[model samples]
Target chain A: MGLTKSEIFSTEQNQLAQLLKALAHPARIAILQELMKSNTCICGDLVEELGLAQATISQHLKELKNAGLIQGTIEGVSVCYCINPSTWEMLEKETSGFFSSFKPAINCC
Target chain B: MGLTKSEIFSTEQNQLAQLLKALAHPARIAILQELMKSNTCICGDLVEELGLAQATISQHLKELKNAGLIQGTIEGVSVCYCINPSTWEMLEKETSGFFSSFKPAINCC
Candidate 1:
């Protein structure tokens, strides 16, 4: 999933899959939660909040950044990170479309 | 992500993350789309539909089934799979909760 074979699917499908893959980890989710709770750019505080090593948190942050889920700005020796609202909105719309596509007709178990 | 550190987060967060991880692949997404299109249990047709190797499709299907996103029934030489509606509903609710939790106030890039 690092680099998906996006040629195999529609752009919407590929984009949706890529975004979902980015959120597929607990560390990343925790990072996003931290950002949400703060409601502002967070810098160098995730390690203390999440109890993970700095390097581990950085890797998770990198993945989130790569997926365009979070944005960062340099501030002194630290990087301030926060959720990218536009991308988050796009994610919400695509995910809602995917999940709500199927109309549960009956218990077809 | 195969077996996440579930103890690190709340049960809801872990479950949602696990579900997203299972869906982190293009093949799995294609499989789900195929299931949705058919509106019934699908068996060996996926190998043909996705154009991936049979083994690859099998593995993807296994991941989806393991995540409770899809349910299968053994029938003769193959297994037929269909969406697990309850799990899908639960996933939708959890995902919506996570995304809608944030009230985007201003353009915070």
Candidate 2:
């Protein structure tokens, strides 16, 4: 029997996993940390901060944008990026919920 | 500028990213969910609960074990698995810290 991977899991499971996948890479994590450590939206500054090229940062930004984790907008000369607040909150809630879902009655270590 | 990916990022970022990678798959997420849903340590039950092949289940279990997310023990008739509580707590803390690290002053989206 052929069953699609996505078909079997609950929507919650799939969504959480997708978000995790988006954040799995070290480069992406570095990009995100740089954005967070900044007080204002970053505009072409990640390349300097992360030591990654502009093209590489843009590629990672694209993946984050696709996952709704980040958003970018064009300013006068540079494109600024920041964490999407609503999705950020959702990620927090869902991730916390997933971690808290397990209540162990007995420890079998 | 030659920069190794892991050499540039902080250890916190790298460890968190690695944990995320381990849980990034839908099958792995589902397997964890199934394990949490069960009351006691599960032994040879994931194949039935997850509707995945034994090989697939074992593979996913190995990944979880490698990440310190789950622990396994040999029972009389079967091997039992349960969540590794310490790593789980660390995951919860680190993930919460990552999400809370962003403090937005103005919406850029």
Candidate 3:
């Protein structure tokens, strides 16, 4: 909600932050976990699985989609959702790179 | 801030989300980059490097410290800050585990 000043940071940093922001909520984390466990496109089961309202689940799903973490497809009448593999790989690589950037100093404050 | 409903998620999920939330800002990302690049405790150089006000830099640094991603120690008149190695390793493991959990489905949605 506040000014993030995203313009000043590198594209990589901003992108990483955006991805992390999408994952900064417990509900989203739960949703992601459910998708991971299913290992297939999930449709309408999330409400029961997460024990959250449909609207709430939908909201979290929308955030995930916006962050390119998940994708939804219309299957007949219902929409099925699953993890976006390319985006997931990108997130993994970027996150790993970010963490690897910090080498622990042997002696420091 | 609104309620995150953290109670519903597992401890690991909550901890990971909290760490991600701390890193959701570009300023914080930049700060982390600076610390990683320095590879040693840095004191009073962030303001000049980041081109942000001292107060703003301090606030970001405080958030990083609170997240246990960084630690600070009083060095004479200035506070020296460096990456917290143990916490960084924890974050790396947790984040890597999270990403590894999502095994992408080959077919379907």
- Ten-residue stretch with the least lDDT total in model 3 chain A: A1-10
* Candidate scoring better on lDDT of 1 and 3: 3
Q: Which model scores highest in TM-score?
A: 3
- DockQ, cand. 1: 0.61
- Tens digit of lDDT per residue, candidate 2, span A8-71? 7889888989999999988898888778888588868888887777888888899999999998
Off by over 4 Å in 1: A1-4, A107-109, B1-4, B107-109
lDDT of predicted model 3:
0.87
CAPRI class assigned to model 1: medium
Query: In candidate 3, how many clashes are counted?
Result: 0
Candidate 3 structure quality by residue, lDDT tens digits, A4-69? 777777898889899999999888888888888887678689988877789889988999999999
Which segments of model 2 are wrong by more than 4 Å? A1-4, B1-4, B107-109
Q: Candidate 3 falls in which docking quality class?
A: medium
Q: After the best TM-score superposition of candidate 3, give how far the Cα of residue B37 lies from its true spot, in angstroms.
A: 0.9
List-wise, what DockQ does each model earn? 0.61, 0.70, 0.79
lDDT of 1 by residue, B26-95 (tens): 7788888888888766789999987677977888888898999989988788787889899999999998
Give the TM-scores of the predictions, in the order they appear.
0.91, 0.92, 0.95
Quantify all predictions' global Cα lDDT against the true fold: 0.84, 0.85, 0.87
lDDT accuracy of residue A97 in candidate 2: 92
